[model samples]
Target: MKHSEEKEMIRDMARRVAEEQVRPLIASMEESDRFPEELVEIYGDLGLLQMWVPEEYGGPGGDLTSVCLAKEEIGKVSLAASTLCANNSIGLILPLLEFGSEAQKRRYLTESAKGRIVTSVAITEPESGSDVASLRTMARRDGDSYVINGQKSWITFAKQSAYMLVFARTAEGKGYEGISTFIVDCKTPGLKIGKAEHKMGRHGAPSYQVSFEDMRVDADCLLGPEGSGFKSCMRILDLNRPTVGASSLGLAQGAMDQAMRYASDRKQFGKPIAAFQAIQFKIADMAMKIGSARALLYDVAAELDSGDMSRLTLLSSMAKCYCTDVAMEVAIEAVQVHGSYGYSTEYPVERFMRDAKLNQILEGTNEIHRLIIARELFGRR
Candidate 1:
């Protein structure tokens, strides 16, 4: 099917699921810090969990644009749920689909599509953060298996995931060339999950510290080839970052929607707030920013689907950074237009604002993306 039709279908499905399954539980989920397993299952039944997997692998074979549109719709309702879905769909599944062996795909992707397993990507260490190549995690070869010993931090869904796509150093080297990727079951003997992190928002999706002490995995667990993990991870990020931007766009859209409704209904100075010039200007700015960001996100997703990977890393970074920043700005301004009511939990704008802040930090930090964009613009020659 054509990409546009696929996107529309996914969007409609996601909107219905979000409203019926996610919106009803947002309050309690956030308050209780619970993962929405039921919602995940619903999405799985709708083929969203495996949208990008090839049809031969028991998936819908949807393009990246469809994935982004679905994520945007889900994000409009619950950022936490949208984030968990996006991470699983892109950060975990995309790498495996792109680089895993046929046997590996058969083993994992099939189960993952059924929502029988949850997966996470482990790259950031307590000491590494944005300096991915400087990671200290080590996996040394021992006969047919490698023994892994390291600590990974800020891993989303780590505690609940059934597997992790781990990046570790296999050789003593100066840079990314030494890194390799492996698929490790969460039940591995030496893998341990630390306490869940307390965060500003998206508390429904918890982050955790994962420690690997002498964990053993067979050579078959290796993804792609040795010394290729960094490139694989980068490629996955390029394809997925547009969805992150789309999530931000979703939050911005929700904020604008709430603001518009509140402005039109709430009266002040004997008139509807929306009728005032000050409120009109804020609404106009929010509309323009959201529209522009949505365009950029969709454009990048389309380019990725066409296999025009060139310049996309930079464009994805740009979209992620710009759209997220705009999300935060628009959400904050939306609250301002709502007055004191926006500050209370009774309103969704405050939650939208909190959710918008998270997009600036995930996928890749906006600060790191700026460096990437600058390098691309100036030509790394």
Candidate 2:
């Protein structure tokens, strides 16, 4: 089969799994505000947990485009699940793939590819969410090992993951150059798992605070060269940003699907709401936004896969900002089309609306994305 054919096949399978297995649990998971470990295991079973891992490691060795396609389908049903699936392709996985020692790769990526473990990354601190240069986490070299001490907030899958990719300060310096990355086992001593946060949306997946007090690890745990982690993190983000846009695009598409069904079934004055020009226009606009955002998202994904960094930074920010913004707009319009029913839990539009809001905030705020895009266009003048 051609690449596109194979991609579509994976997408169809994801949709079937979502409809058959995930849809039944969405309501209960949303009500309870609990992460769905079963659903995550389903992803592992489907080989999505290692979708990006190289074939040498017993993975599919797929590209960012394939990852985005999978995310788009899973996100259509549950953003929480999509977020979990995306973690495997983003922050932790890429750095390890590029810079990890052969032993480190065989130890971590191999198990992850086999679905024997889940993973996460710890980079966002309480004080240094996006201003990574100001992170206060300290990792002091202690003779063949590093003693790490710090706290990380808003970490997803921290409790569920077996390992975490941690970034900390290894030298006294002003900005990103002093940072280093480490692969720390979650079971390490001096590591504390804090309370899970009750977030507004993606209720099926919980974020948490993680604290490391005198957490020590062998020098082999170091992922890359000393003081080069900031660049690694940025590289990871550049690669994953388009996948985030794909998730948002999926949410918008899902909202539109619900709206169309509701509009067709709902009737007023002896006619379906779909007959009304106002409803027609809204649906038309929703489709247009989704189409446009998808184009940019896939374009950026291809560029990222091609390893052309020249235009990727700017293009990725455009996709993340525009696509997520479209998601918010389309979700709200979906709710509007459904009227009071949309606000009610009976309809999925309200949930989509709530979920859409987060895409704008996480993976770097759309505002920050706009700034990045602008800076790229105008330069530092």
Candidate 3:
């Protein structure tokens, strides 16, 4: 598929920023578990956060391909930072575009596009991970307000967000139809944050458990219609999954690049390791896998861009599962090539390995994705 000049320009710009700006500070950010607020502001100024939003709403009105390209570039440097950008771009901004009322869009998208406000989606809970329909959080209607009460776990950027797009149960029915989504200001009354989870990877992006006890939102805060939360959330995930795959592709590419560099420089048996057939095979495999993954991701992005929504669920899930799994494999091989240094914090592979693992688990686990894929193949619901 041919890409526009604008897409190529955005990709180049993002790659330069990732290599020059984000990559240098990744180690420090990982060590301290600090969110890169300064970097985010720079991305905002560059319109990274609002690339997909309509131009009227303070965005460049770019397509999904541009978003994926930017994400891939950033992911190559730091998956945590890429995820932060993705969260705002897809998790927060896209949903608003799809379902937000005109007033809500004017209020949120403008600030989010400008990077003045950070946003995140609250959906996963302690007991509800892939089984989103099983979530127990409730948002009860009361005189022109919904009193939300529940605990949301593993919420990304919960510590730094100004607002969160929350999902909760509003009806007493079974399955996805009972769920609803709301836009809640993070500092609203009766909202409390639990301790940040010490994760295996992506430490630079913190996750938290948020508690909402009688937290109230005006009726206008509702996203889309009642009982449509689960569908809207799934749609957003479908749109975002390719970006996740792109992120995985970036990490794998980084690992491949690092491994090749190490093999060239590191000497063994009086010769550089790159000369050895074993190291050569690893590099070949890494390159091949990353190429295939990138192709799949781009195909999905192209399909979305062309307004081909059929089979999106299957394609997105496949890309998410395949790319992430490949990233994990590439990270391991990269570390193997690095030998002892890979295990140490002195090298970035250890962190890359951690960040790669989360991609398989998030946006629905690989196991759940397989189910979706199988269902599609068999023509099952």
Candidate 4:
């Protein structure tokens, strides 16, 4: 698979931005647990924020593979900065690009590309967890508007987004059949943004719990069609899962890069740590794991771009689960290679460890992914 010139340019640009801007803000943002608002503006200016959007909708018209390339380069410097791209490509902007109405695209996608607004997706609830069908959010029709009532938890960028793609029950029934999707203005009445969550890492990207009480939107706000929310949800994951996997791939590669540099530069017993066979083995293993994960993730991304959904679901799960696990393992090894400095905030490996842990839990837990893969293997679609 040869890389495109556009993708190469995007990767180089992301790397330069991360090195010059995002990495400089990492320490300050993490200390304050505040999202890096300035860096996001920079990303928007570079068109990285809307790379997932099509050209017709006012974006760079890049594919998932290009987005992954950009993410890997940025993650090498700052995981939180890379997340800004992930949030857009995976579910937020991609969904609208895929299913939004012409009017919706013209307004939302165009503005999103211009950096006029930030967006989020609200699906996970407190009780529902990974059970998308068990969601308790209800949107009752009232004349030309729908009144929504529910709470969404662990919503990425909820506190900062100007709009959110909300999934709620629109009819009385069991499972996913009654669900629907809506694009709600965050300023809508009765929509309350909760406090930013204090997390283990990636503090530069914040998450929150959002409560919708009597939040009302016009009928025009509905995305796709009524009772089609569940299908849209599946489609969203199918499209962006490869990007999630790539995020983990980037984190692992970043940790490996840092560890390798430290090993070659730092000395132990009056000699460079790189000279020790034990340290050499760690570097070798880290490189191998990172390479393997990148291959799997990019293969899946290529399939995504090819419009061949045949085994994408299985491959995406494999990429997300395997790459994230490798990220955690490699990050820990990175810490081990650096000894005490790795455990401290002085080195970014500790942050990498924390961010990599979140990847496994979000975008469907690894346990659930295993179930999906097993189901696919058992001939149960």
Candidate 5:
């Protein structure tokens, strides 16, 4: 869990921004499920928006570990803020850096680093959540363009993005190879963005249903080779899942911090709850879980930053699954320690509990992650 001086600076900067800037917006966002429109520019200015993009493209040239540190610190204050940072950095910027053509990277990265061309990745459909091969969206090749037609569900920030990376079925194949990704402009004629979902928490980062009714993008818009999109995404997610773990770790830590503070001050039976062995045990367990999960997530991130993919999938899934489960447990215990005040919005634990649930569901449900982990375990033997 030790960090370099540079990374320590990055974490501190993110924490300051979260407490001073992001905390002020949470109430409004939770009140109305508002889109975090203001966060994009703030993240961009701070270089958290595209932390992994190289410096040649007018970016900060930071790595994924730096991004994770930023996410964890920011997450302690706002899951929505952390989610926004992750989605843009992992979902779009990383792909563009790894797979985009030179011209595409120059254009997109420059725009993105400037916070001008906000981005979203569209992959999931109504029928396809964990099953990427089951996607029904079609992008048929035409003379000079491809016409895409299908509906995408739960596309985060689709309405706010100027450009979207849309994955669709481009040919007939039994496996993931049939799919392709197109960088479609959101203003393209046949694209429609629907209303955002009202989730239990993280309302600031909106997820919407997007429809592509014959939406056309030029031939050059296809990212990487034809039919390589799904595989490339699998590679990216190997990096992404662990970053989600980082966010969850922050949430668990934040809740633990709050619980400790409350237990130290709140009195029961003419004494503070901190004096009670039961409350002390709960706090002890929370700290233990958070510490272990942090160690795992940080190690996974460091391994990834070293450019080693041999253990990436298994470790990433473990990080995602374990950290999120820890977050859920810690959030609930933090709530329990608060007694009646926990259920009320008086303390942030209620919001923490609500937000903690979504981390388990996002980046693939924990059930799906377990299957993946098991599959990898046996497949490697």
Candidate 6:
């Protein structure tokens, strides 16, 4: 699995950016409990904010693998930065690219590529967590506009976004077919962004509750076909899940890095703990799992780069599920390897461990990913 020079360069660039830019912002972001706004401009300057943008749109046309490679580097330092990067490049942009009309693309996509106009997604609700079809949001068509009414919880970067990909039901139904996706301006009259939720990790990347009360948008704001949003939702996740795997891969790698250093330096009975059989065994297991997850994630990303979707759903779910699991496992082991110091804020393994916990639940929860994987296997068409 040899990588192209371009992809490797993208990965290296991200590493440099993470080390130089992200490290300086982490403490401030953690203290403020908010994503650093300056990064939006910084990443935009590097064209790293949204790697999926194509050359035609004034972007570098970086592919899915490039996105993961960069994310793997950034996630090693901060999942908050990585999460923002993914949201800009994958979560919200993919849907627009896939379904948005040319005019829509011209107005939004170009600015998005530049990181000037950030977009957030609104799909999950309090009641319908993982069940997209069961969502209760409604959008009623008026003369030449649609009025929306709903509340979306756990929406990342909603407060800072210029626009949002809001999913609402256009037809009278509780099923997936009735849903439609719309691009709405955040400053629209009836849209209100709620406070960010208190979370266990990635405090800088906060998830907010967004409420819309008769929020109206022009008819042209409709993305793709009306009544096709649920499908679009699935499509976006299919595009997004692998990057999560890549970020999780970084998380696992970061934790292992801490543990490796700790083991080499920390003394036990008489010498370096790295000399101990138990420590060697732990490091070996971490390497084995991390390598396995990376191979699977890279293979999946490469297939996506080749425009192969025959096994997309199955592999994407596997990559996200397995990689996050490995992250969680490795982070815990990293902590254990550090003994008491691992749990303290002085060492980074504790932060990695906290960050690892959130990866399991983001995008699609691991439980939902399992269901997706099982469904794809059993009901493959």
The global Cα lDDT (0 to 1) of model 3 is 0.87
Evaluation by TM-score, superior candidate among 2 and 5:
5
What TM-score does prediction 2 earn? 0.96
Q: After superposition, which runs of candidate 3 have C-alpha atoms over 4 Å from their true positions?
A: none
Task: Compose the digit string of candidate 6's lDDT tens values, residues 51-147.
Answer: 7877787776878888888888999988888877746755456877898888988777677777665678899899988778889989999999999
Which pairs of residues clash in candidate 5, taking residues 3 or more apart in a chain or in different chains?
A: none
Off by over 4 Å in 6: none
Assess candidate 1 and give its TM-score to the true structure: 0.96
Clash count, predicted structure 6: 0
Candidate 1 runs further than 4 Å off: 1-3
Candidate 2, after superposition: displacement of residue 174 in Å? 2.9
Candidate 4 clashing pairs? none
> How many collisions per candidate?
0, 0, 0, 0, 0, 0
For all predicted structures, in order, the TM-scores are 0.96, 0.96, 0.97, 0.96, 0.97, 0.97
Query: By summed lDDT, which 10 consecutive residues of candidate 2 come out lowest?
Result: 84-93
User: On TM-score, who's better, 4 or 6?
Assistant: 6
Report the lDDT tens digits of candidate 5 across residue range 136-238.
Answer: 8999999999999999999888888888888998987646989998888889999999878878887788889999998888999898988998887787777
Candidate 3: worst 10 consecutive residues by lDDT?
A: 83-92
lDDT per prediction?
Answer: 0.85, 0.86, 0.87, 0.84, 0.87, 0.87
